[model samples]
Structure formats: structure tokens, C-alpha cells
Target: MKRQHSHLTPHHPLSGAETTAAEIVSGVDLTGRRAVVTGGASGVGVETARALASAGAEVTLAVRDTGAGARTTEDITATTGNQGGRVAHLDLADQDSVAAFVSAWEGALHILVNNAGVMASPELRTPEGWELQFATNHLGHFALALGLGPALARDGGARVVAVSSSAHHRSGVVFEDIHFRRRAYEPWSADGQSKTANVLFAVEAAKRRAADGVTVNALMPGGIRTDLQRHVSDAELARLRARAAGGAELEWKTPEHAPDPEAAALLWQDSQDTLAAKG
Candidate 1:
């Protein structure tokens, strides 16, 4: 299938499952670059921050748990010997927290990693009545990126990485009932919809921000057991493990299957409207 964006080049030879983050960025210099990784206190977020810091980027961990963020900062600094590591509080589910973080940010931002997310959680909602997964995984990151647009565009060649998942193939955005107002809540379906939104956000943001030299993309970090799976039961975990052992191939959704330009635009507008209404 034809790709819609020029930036969607073929995968790099080094991007295989065995490739580590450190290896991907080996010998690369980011001496004066500034980066922020949401949920940088744990999981892949910690590793991402460490790798960026190792590359000499001034890294900030935007996390809800400042204590954990501080601990991660120290660990990264100790491991990388890069004193530029810092931590700031950010709760993606809270618009005010996102706004404050954006407002507090200074100067150009070379990289923003939308890495924090909840998975397969029980039914939950934000103050605005938005589903918890969608709110944090998509809309919160959406607002953060939008708010930081100027900072991101200040210097050419800024990058925004949205951590989506292969699970996006499970479901597309249900515009009619995104928050499950009428529809019954199902954990994985909500997660899939939100993950799809992450991709759509990248698609639309890339198109709109291309003129600003801001590159946006989504990635599926192949199944690693992380705290993100905290909500899964033992039975479900065992089933997933069995499936993985069976060598089940992950079929990613094609652009034709979902995340079309029209859908992207509609989602962007709807997200804007939703946030505005809440305000």
C-alpha cells in the first residue's frame, strides 16, 4: 500500500526486535538538544531518558510521581554520568497539569516522547467524562503537543514520538461513543481505540506541522512485560504468554484500514472541541 506521508520510509535495517535503544542511538550526539519523556520514571520511559541523556541531551522526566521521577533522574545520572537529567510533574489525565507543564517549559524542545499510558484498566473517567485510557493516552498528549507547538517549532527538525501499539489493530476510534457514554465498557477495546487515536494524532500532526519542520510519528514497542500491564489478571497474562509462545504474528492496521486523513482531521477537530468545552 502507498504511504500517505513522505516521512514514512521503509524500516531501518537496525530496527529489528533485537535492537536496543542504546544501539539505535549509538555515536549520535545530541549535546545541546532538549528532550522530555512522559512517564520517564518507569518502564521503557526510564530507558529512553537514560539513552537520550547518554547522548548528551538535557532530559526531563515529566511524570505524575515526582519521587519516582527524582529517583529515576538520579539513576540515569549515575548510569550515564549526565548531570542534565531533571524531573517535572505531569499527570496526563489532568488538563491543568499538562497546561502547567507546557506553560513552564522554556526555549526550544528538540524531542517530546509521548510514552506514558495505562493498559486494560477497569472503567475510569476524567473530570470531563472522557474515558481514562483515551484521556491519558490520546487527548492529554494531544493537548500537550498542541500547547507546545511553538516550542517544538522554535527550532527546525523537532521530533514528536507517540508510543502507540500493535493493539491499535484491535479497534478504530468510535466517534459516536468515544467515552462509552452508551456503549458498554470493555478494557481492551478502550485501549485499542485510544491507541488508534495516538496514530491518528501523529498522522494529522505530521501533516499540519510539516511546514514547521516538526516530525511526528507513532511506534509499536514490541510486547515487553511492563507495569503498563498492571491491570491484567493472572489468567489473562497466562493466555497472552501462551499466545506469544505460539509465535502469533501481529498484523498491524494499514492506513486504508484506519487513520485516513479525513478521520485524522475529524479527530483533531473533535479533540479540540472537547477540550474547549471542558474549559
Candidate 2:
């Protein structure tokens, strides 16, 4: 995908430089609200969970590691004095876990943050034969969001946030062979495709659920060193640094901007049909 340049228009009040999540949601109370943040056990996800809980929302840390998830939830409760935080096991790479999580969810959901993702891993496939990056980063989140539609729509106003990445500019979704069945598997390209899918998923979700008072948004949280980069090698890091030194600035965009609606609708339907077949 080519870069869609914007003229530095500020859409939100907070700049990544100095804005904390607590500061961004200041003055708004989330008491009685229910929220979920996938991958909330560590990294940026932990901060997101803490901020939501701080605002008094009942939060569930959907994590792959139950032990880590429990610890993270405890830490958030201690730091924010919000005891509504809890943990639920979720492995985006596994469909059974997705369904189980959905089944266990109770009551109306006000906020959902599809923040978990895997990046730059070796060529791998889920049990369903989908590419690992696409499966975990996009399709799994897609399924989770759709599965939670009843809870989200129960409330008049709800929000779903997909944490995409600036890497989306590198490539679009490989629709024809999303699993890399017929193409060579390159780490960066796989990661880029997954990120692109995240934005498109949000776009379609917004379009379909707008009438239900549920809005979906995608965001690129400005670069931060986190476990998300665990798969990157020393050589890859040096290469990235070299590119950064050459004046390649990572572009961040608000959720209002995404791929065309046509592409989004197509991806949405494709994802729906894919998941249905698997079921």
C-alpha cells in the first residue's frame, strides 16, 4: 500500500508526545460500564486496561497467559483502586478459545479494545489454515467483535477500537491468497497485511453497526518499544534504525481515515463467510 499523506490535521486533542490515557479520558466517568482489552497482560495493553479501570469501567484482561493476566489485573486494581478488573484466557491464534471467551462473556459491553497482535514471526498457520498474522491480528479480532455484537448493541452507545499500526502503509490485504499459500512468506509483508486488515475491519464494523449506536475505530498508537517487537532481530532493528535516520517518519492517522468502504465491505463479508465455514 502507498502512503496516504495528511496535512498534519489534528483530529483529537491529545498528541502522543504528552497525552496519557487517564488524561485523555479525564472528566468522563465510566462507572457501571463494562470493557475488555485483549493482550492487556503487558505492554501498551496494560496501560490501556489500567486507564479504563481508573475511569471506573469493569474491565476484563483477555490474555493468552492466565497467570500473567491474573497478575496484570491485580496490578491494575492496586494502581487504580478499581477492583472491577479481572482476567480471562484468550489466545487469538486459536478459534476454540475465541468461541469460549464469547460464551463466557456476560452483560452489556460498552468498550472493546482489540489490542492484541503478533508481528514479524516465521511463516506460520493457524489450525484453520490461515496465516498466523492475519488470523491472530485481524480475523480473530474480527470474530471476537462480531461475536460480541449482542452485548455491544444492548447498550445504546458502544465503541470498538482496533489497534492498527503504521506498518499498514507497506502493503494492503492479500485477499487472493491471504494465507500465503501461493506466495512467498516475508515477515514484514505479513505484518503489514494484518495491520491493513485491522483498519478495514474497523471501517466495515462502523458501517454495519452505526445504526445500532456502536461505532468501530482503528488507531496507530505512536511507536513505543514493547514486547510487540519481540520477534525482530538485531539485524532487523539496525535496518529499521537506518531507515529512521534517513528521515522516514512513521505516519499516524486517526480512525476516521481508512481504506475505501468498498474494500472494507468486501473484507467484512469475506471474514464472516470464512468464520461461518469454520464453525
Candidate 3:
């Protein structure tokens, strides 16, 4: 009922349908917004797609797999009463996939939700030699945004929500050795580097496009047991799920508890624009 930028999203409990960020946007009508979500077939991505379609926004799910996306798209249509959901092939690991996706997209764009990410996994690199986490989590989205700069600009204003992480505070961006060329690579170290890149990318993009109406903001998705941790061992997951003070160890939110993917589109609406997505 009330909106305050200073008041952070509360996490004690979810009462009504709007309790979560995605749920809060369930009632919102994004009848004209066009959105793209990466790695959106499972976990928080599902909730993200559901909320946007529920709000009437045309959603393009960029995934590495299409079969899995069919299931996700069906669930979205079932919940939203809209068929604006479509799946587009995207392998953040491949530059060709990124390039092809950008080349084919047409019309006025409204929102870009950089929700795709790779978590603590083994060290690897893309074809171009960029580190895995930094590549998929940061560079891929960076390229996608820059590629679609025209669409975002043509619309006059657009919203770019970069889903960063609390892990960012663990370490800042490693400018000189982003690829850890000089150090032995660790899983969490890569994850932290990727998260830090998320924030830095957002801050830089926001500054560059502020005059063009592309207001970028980064926020932590809070702790949730999403498939992003599938690479984690069973024992590691058990520890994270364990409760310490007679309750949950992390006070973590469920997939539903994570911020709704559509909230950005709704909250940015103002008296001046007929559009739902604002830069």
C-alpha cells in the first residue's frame, strides 16, 4: 500500500498473494511490456515468468534448452490467462547464441531482466577466454544490453533490473586479474567475482544511460534454495538448509519468497508515462 525507496523489501513472512515481489506484481497489468529472462525455466525464474505473464507482459525466456522451456511456458500461460510467453534459445556460454538472439529481436523493448546466472561451479572459460562466472553472469548480459541499446532507447525509457547478490559485499571486482590468471581458482571465489561484477555493471550502465531513460538498479535476491545450487554437494546443501537458533539457519526465503520479477515494471510507472517500464 505504501512505497518507500528507503524501506527494504521485508522478509518475515508472506501474508497475501503480494507478499513476495513477484506476488506483489501479480495484480499489475503489464499489457504492453516486452521482457526477456535468462535461465528462467526453474526455481526463481519460474516465479519471475509467472508474475510477468500474469501482469500481461510479453515474456521471452532465453534458455539453453527449449524442451524444459515448454513446460515453463505452459505453467505461465495456465497461471496468467495469457499466451504471450515464448521461449528463445540462449546459451550464455556461446557468443553465437547471444548474437543471434539480439539480431532477431524486433519492435519497441520495455524491460530487460538479467536474471540468468551461473553459480559456484568449476573454473572454466568461454570461447573468448573470459572466466565462466564473469562471462555468463556479467559479460553475456553486458553484450545483450549493449546489443539492444537501440530498442531500449527507441522506447524513450526502459528498466534494466540486474539481479545481483549479497555475495557482492564479500569482494569487489578484480579489475587487473578478473580471470584469476595469477591465482588458483575456487568456486565461491568465482561466484563472488561474478556477483561483484553484477553491481559494477549496473552502476556503470545506469550512469551511461541515465539521460536515455535507462535507470539500472541492482539488488540481492536473498537466500533461496534455487537450482542455482544444484552443483553443490548434498552435504553442502544440508548445511545451508540446517537451522541454528531453533529455526532456519539463513532465514532464507522460498522461491516464492524471492523478489517478484515483474515488480520493477509496475513500481516504475508514473504520472507522466503511459508506459509501465521506465528507465
* Predicted model with the maximum lDDT: 1
Arranged by lDDT with the best first, the candidates are 1, 2, 3
Tens-digit lDDT track of model 3 for 194-255: 77666666656777788988888776766778878878888876775464235652433223
| lDDT of each residue in 82-168, candidate 1, tens digit only | 999989999999999999999999999999999999999999999888999999999999999999999999999999999988677
What is the C-alpha lDDT profile of model 2 across 216-243, one tens digit per residue? 8888886677898999987877877776
The TM-score values for the models, in the order shown, are 0.92, 0.90, 0.78
- Two-way TM-score contest, 1 vs 2, winner: 1
Worst 10 residues of 2 by lDDT: 2-11
CA displacement after TM-score superposition, residue 174 of candidate 3 (Å) = 1.2
For candidate 2, give the lDDT of residue 209. 94
The per-model lDDT (C-alpha) reads 0.88, 0.85, 0.71
User: What residue pairs clash in candidate 2, if any at all?
Assistant: none
Query: Candidate 2: lDDT over CA atoms?
Result: 0.85
Clash pairs, candidate 3, are: 21-260, 22-260, 215-279
Per-residue lDDT for 36 in model 2?
Answer: 95
